[model samples]
Target: LHNTSDYRVLLMDEDHDRMYVGTQDYIVSLDLHNINREPLIIHWPVSQQRRDDCVLSGKDQNGECANFICLIQPWNRTHLYVCGTGAYHPICSYVNRGRKAEDYIFHLEPGKVESGKGKCSYDPKLNSVSSLINRELYAGVYIDFMGTDAAIFRTMGPQTAMRTDQYNSRWLNDPEFIHAQLIPDSSERNDDKLYFFFREKASDSGSSAVYSRIGRICLNDDGGHCCLVNKWSTFLKARLICSVPGPDGIETHFDELHVKNPVIYAVFSSSGSVFKGSAVCVYSMTDIRTVFNGPFAHKEGPNYQWMPFTGKIPYPRPGTCPGGTFTPSMRSTKDYPDEVINFMRNHPTMYNSVYPVHKRPLVVRTNVNYEFTTITVDQVDAADGRYEVLFLGTDRGTVQKVIVLPKDEMEREELILEEVEVFKVSQQLYVGSTLGITQVTLHRCDVYGEACADCCLARDPYCAWDGKACSRYSASSKRRSRRQDVRHGNPIRQCRGYNSNANRKTMETEQYGVEGSSTFLECQPKSPQATIKWVLQREGSDRKKEIKSDERILRTDQGLLLRSLQLADGGIYQCTATENNFKHALVRVHLRVLNNETVNLVLTHSGLPMASLQGVGSPGTSRAPNPQYKDLLQLLSQPEMGVINQYCEGYWQRPANIEKQNLNKQQKDKPVREQRKPRNRRNHHTSWPQLPLLANHCQ
Candidate 1:
């Protein structure tokens, strides 16, 4: 695990408590409960001849011409069908584990390797998706070595192999496959369909526009009789639109798709370089089906625009499977008329585009550096109701745990990682990257904090306040005793009896700042949703006034920054947070500004020679004090006089040659001075050198 690389694919078999990982030249099987334990590894490197041939064909020997395992699908109860870019040739073999979970025997089956032309991609960089249903492999992959022939193929089944129209841009044009799913349309087995989600170059558009697509084909479709033999007779694809409305009737499109099924959660990103953005859109199966059933797009002539076809529809619609509920009379697509087959070929794309459930994205992030790469959703049954928690992975090696509350409010917490390739099974998330694989728990309820307000303000559906501590919420637990408000997160209303320190006095810390120097009052709010405000009460005053930010006084998310500290800035500053109409004081700082004269007096009394303090109050002098004198002055300004005296005594006790060496190095590194015009004495005060306070150094 430490030395191996390219750990990009992960397949979990929860029933057997094993996770299979695919990497370069190896397929690894690890224990679900403990990954660090000895894992079963199978070496599946490419043959020397194949590697030589790949290199001869202009592929990198170390990178491209390698056995990079990219696919691992369950072939049966105890066997896995694995495929790899076999030195650019693309080969697959079956991996055999024991029949039962207790049997730990795992190995690659010998003499079963086969050519994977249609099952896997030739290039490891190209994306592909596949789903095994009824022992047949339905894949969205490139069929050629050059990767120009992108197609959705059905192979490794009893029936004749079927695929999309070869070399037809209308079917697939530079497609980048995202995901594949086998969804049952009815109780009948033959009615089941295989759906492929991808993004491809738009065929109808003249420009280089890409569009996300949802393409589906009937599972039972064999071939056509006369027009399209050995090709799919029920292939239909629809545009998947995930966009946000902009000004002047313009819409911003998110064309790149990373999709998951079953209440489909698709992460889409804008392809435009100027406005980088990502969005999460949720789609229902009903809406996808409706779009597929709508009118088909057609072109009237060579240069005609794409529009809805008004021609008479063929019997047993072009996308319908044989012997399904709608068309029980036909037993095979070969029995359909030539008109139906030709129409299906000419109009594989639908007219209407499929929109998300709410016609908008659940989460939108614009002008961000990273794009969403993968997503997985887990529905949790909390005390109130069920909430869908989305774990969205980003290209920047992070995962965002997001939840949408009632009234369309959303909250998110980010989990950092080295890299991200996420696969979730049960309560564990298996993340794969080039470094290695990592297993993480679904919920860490204890990290929210101990206070009731802290727990409630988190608004995480997986955690709640159980009177004593913040812990994982269970539906069976007594709801009346627990405190959780994910919808509104009104901590004041929900934590009335839990906040015992509501009336406790706020603690104030003494902070010193030098006059004409800058210092920050640090105060971080516990909750990101809370609004921070600062108030100042002058010394010996009874009234407190709200502090407004100006050029010198800036309020940041962390705290308030007081620049060029003045005597008026010396006051008790209080940091407050307001959330859900509930206000609480977070921190208080009693700032005391030290003038230049006080600093000079402190330095003079610290046993420093008068020569070191000669230019302390003067400005624009060519003969300045040594730089080490400034370090001594900074140390002497601290209240810990005993430590300062100890350090000074030790400094002077160093060898005299070492002190001379230090002085020589300082003078050697100093920059040469340039002549400048003299300033009028009346226009500027003598710029005294200010020593930074110990508190500022700590901050």
Candidate 2:
């Protein structure tokens, strides 16, 4: 962990309360509860000869010419099979730990290192996926030194080591593996299959196009006897389509895949840079099985397009497991006929593509700056029902927390907590980056607020209002007392008797402004989804009227802006927020407008220099004073001006050159202000006051 980079969470053993992490030149075992506890570290740097050879072959000395631990699979209860890019020469070894968690000892087993040619990738930059299934390693990796030959290999078991057809573009063309999952098709062990998710260059769609794919191989396959010896006979792949339908009869496809299983949650991104986007698609195991059982894709010749095979189907279909329920008599692929093996080799691609649930993506983000790189899902049993919570990682190093409502709507909330990659296990999240790993809780329910309405409107499945503060929700708790409505997020219906601030009076702040100057009333809502409205009642009028934007008055998210204040604008303005048909007043402002005569009298009585107030009433001056001075004169009342004058006298008594240097520094360091492009600048101006600057000299 000290001298390594590119840290990846490899395995989480909850029973032992340890999480295994693999990084460059090291394999680390961290305590699940407290990562700050000294981790069990193993230093496995590449040999000097391998590093020299890697550098001589034109790989980077610091980056590519180093041992990068990539795979750590549980071989048994006491051993783990670890693999790494040993400076471009892949190697594997067995790590020894004690049989029990209490007596665990972490060390590399001596003299057990072997070549990992087919089970690991030589280059650390290339993508590979592997799963240790029943002592057999099912891996999708590039098998050659130059990283050109990619294949799915089944090795290290009692059966003969079998792989996909080597150097065959029709089988796998430049595939970048994402994940490997072992899904049991039935109760029988032989019916279990290993599925690989990847994105590769499409052979049928020319060289530039890439497509997402889901490929599977039966666990019981033992290679064919004569036709395809030492090759997979039950290997079949199908296109995974995640696309958006367009009005022009064309579909925009997302081709890069990042997948997680048990209900496949796939995060995909568009390959093209011009249309940047990412989407989350959910695929069912039933849908994937149906596509593999459908017709196979066949090509007549080199010039012909791929079409569904209409020829006579062979018995015990090409993709069927050798010892499954369909063909229990055939114990292995070696028992299959030569004709069936030959047919399987020529047609490994399924004709029908697999579509996600709802025939569309669950979440889609287009024209965004960041692409989703990884994802994890949590299925929670809320007070109402069950809900799936998605934690999506973006390339810009932030996790987006999204929850799918019962009405097929998605509410996305972002946690800008860390700039690190996220991994979820059980109820906690482990985020890792070059700096280190940090553990985060799934929900910080106290952040919602102390009010029940706030907790109910948050719509978070993990949190609810328990007649007091917001806390974690449990299904076994008193459901009728806790308030949670994830489906509608209607706080009015959920927090009827629990809202404490429902009848509280709105606090009013007194604000003074000059007749020719400007002022702003500040009010911000607690919730982002709330709608804000401003209503004003005059000093004498009893009826209140809603304020609409005009040349003099403008509304903004922060508050209401009143420019060039007039006498008619003196009133009590209330800022109200409407959410779920519930109205609440956020703030109230009582405004008082002062005329030019009153402002001039206040400045004179304050004992300030007449030179600084020269342009207050006269209009024939060559150059006006700084506008900030006018703002200061408008803001200070008669009682406060005396103290302000004392501060100003001490501020101006400094040397002239010091003031000049300060002015120059301010002019040089001031940031360029951005202006709204659509609004007319002729009447609109800044309503908020700024720091006062005295440009006029006192003699």
Candidate 3:
């Protein structure tokens, strides 16, 4: 249950329903269904002499000498390839699952230690990332013990092992590797490409500053033949930006970020030096691709000014996969001319900076002190709808679930559904070192629900709407007997015209307020996409004037606002919305305005002096009500404040001369009109044929 500070490496095997955990001096495999079950443990501690040497060298044995498995990956169908910071010496090995005995669950392939320096981090605190493709392992790690010689290396291939230009600040300036993946060409017309996401120091503007970057390399990039021998010829990186919208037209950048492809979700604080709070910004794949396709940066001859290269480019553009005229059989990076490789070495970083797809972040939590270390996505089926739930793991052993909903054309709604406590530890060791999540796996939908609606709505790639229900067809017998294609199954087809419930159109509500008190008349639309309109039906008149926000009226996202109440304000207010330009929704409010004589008595009982309540205005004021009112008047305006003197004052003071009208049947078929600008009329008297004149009496 507790890995403490060493939850840095994890690998999940879905076929076996098992998750491998790599920690200090051990690698354990736990049951995916129940983590509480007995785990298969393998002791991978360092040798005694190595531990002694680590301690003698003034390093803590518990911290540095332990064999912490930094990388645990599947080699093939029957074996797992593993590597660790072998007591600062670094080692690699393979675990043969076929050779396992009844007593021992694991057996290592016997061989002398191979170089793991490039495969793992020397200091467990330093970051490292690796990916396996075509029997080759591509890694980003520090090559020296000083933690300065960083490089991107490709090994375990028939061609000579290659790496980035070493000790070159232009290529990699103090990079902290985060993630690596091999992306195959979707059209299968180009060579496979490898990508790396990290944050590194930049020297673009003659100054050093940290910036997030996305770098890419080709699979067939065997070291350059001429000037750049044994080094990558196609390495290139671009800057990434996820900043808060500034108030004074300034751009407040958040350089620290974490990327999960399709959507690169980043956590940015107030600044890099301070952790005032954190914001989660989401960038789409299109934004990242746009920056990659932008013009590359080039250095001028004399002034050394970095500018976008606009001259005629050479054959086989830098950082591009072999394709078209540039095929693998035709020529690899190894055969590239010296002029091409030399240009790439000088201009590894791009000129154009990448920005987030949305103007704002999907989720921006300002007060959270804990930094986010990783993110994993899951498609969840709920009663309301399908949600792309973000399972964000923090360095403080807390995981948060986030959902992004669309609000408007340029805005999004970020909902933090819940926060789960993963560990019971009272104290944490480091700021961002303890309880780091290495992997997160969401189970298949066959275990979710039996109802087809819930299952299909989940939209999980692992699930299919199998006519009868949403089921995991991949594991079902129907997959083999009927030859069902789970990947191509259409879940959305089963959910057409699936309206859970219809919206209520007509609503009745009541409000009470003092003559000079300000109040809010709420009439929010059920759907966020709907537009709201307010109409005022004046007392003792058959006219209903369309209301708009001006000096005395204010419009808000929630509802409409009336600056201050008066005798003329007493009327029936109609709030309506038209969604999809057809369906209508509305609510009616009967506002009751009290005179000074009635409010004065009500405030006397609420424990306020008569002089303090003078701001309620005179009994008969010719001018309009004041923009501000006293606290007592504001309190008496609220309907809930009626309890203060319910028995003595009869709560709401109603005009004894007014008469009520029964129009429930007429209000049922209320017609919705198209939205338009409210007409400017001095006499506040207008009639609509579609709207019937209902009684303006208040209860």
Off by over 4 Å in 3: 1-5, 98-104, 204-208, 301-305, 323-329, 381-386, 424-699
Per-residue accuracy of model 1 over 103-190 as CA lDDT, tens digit each: 9979999899999989889998887788887788988888898989988888897988989999889888999999998889989887
Candidate 3 lDDT at 291 equals 74
RMSD of 2: 5.9
Residue 273 displacement (Å), model 3 = 3.9
The better candidate by TM-score, 1 or 2, is 1
| Number of the top TM-score candidate | 1
Give every collision pair in model 3: none
Candidates in order have lDDT scores of 0.79, 0.78, 0.64
Clashing residue pairs found in predicted model 2 = none
Q: Any idea what lDDT model 1 has?
A: 0.79
Model 3 Cα shift for residue 542 (angstroms): 33
Tell me the TM-score of model 3: 0.61
Inter-residue clash pairs, candidate 1: none
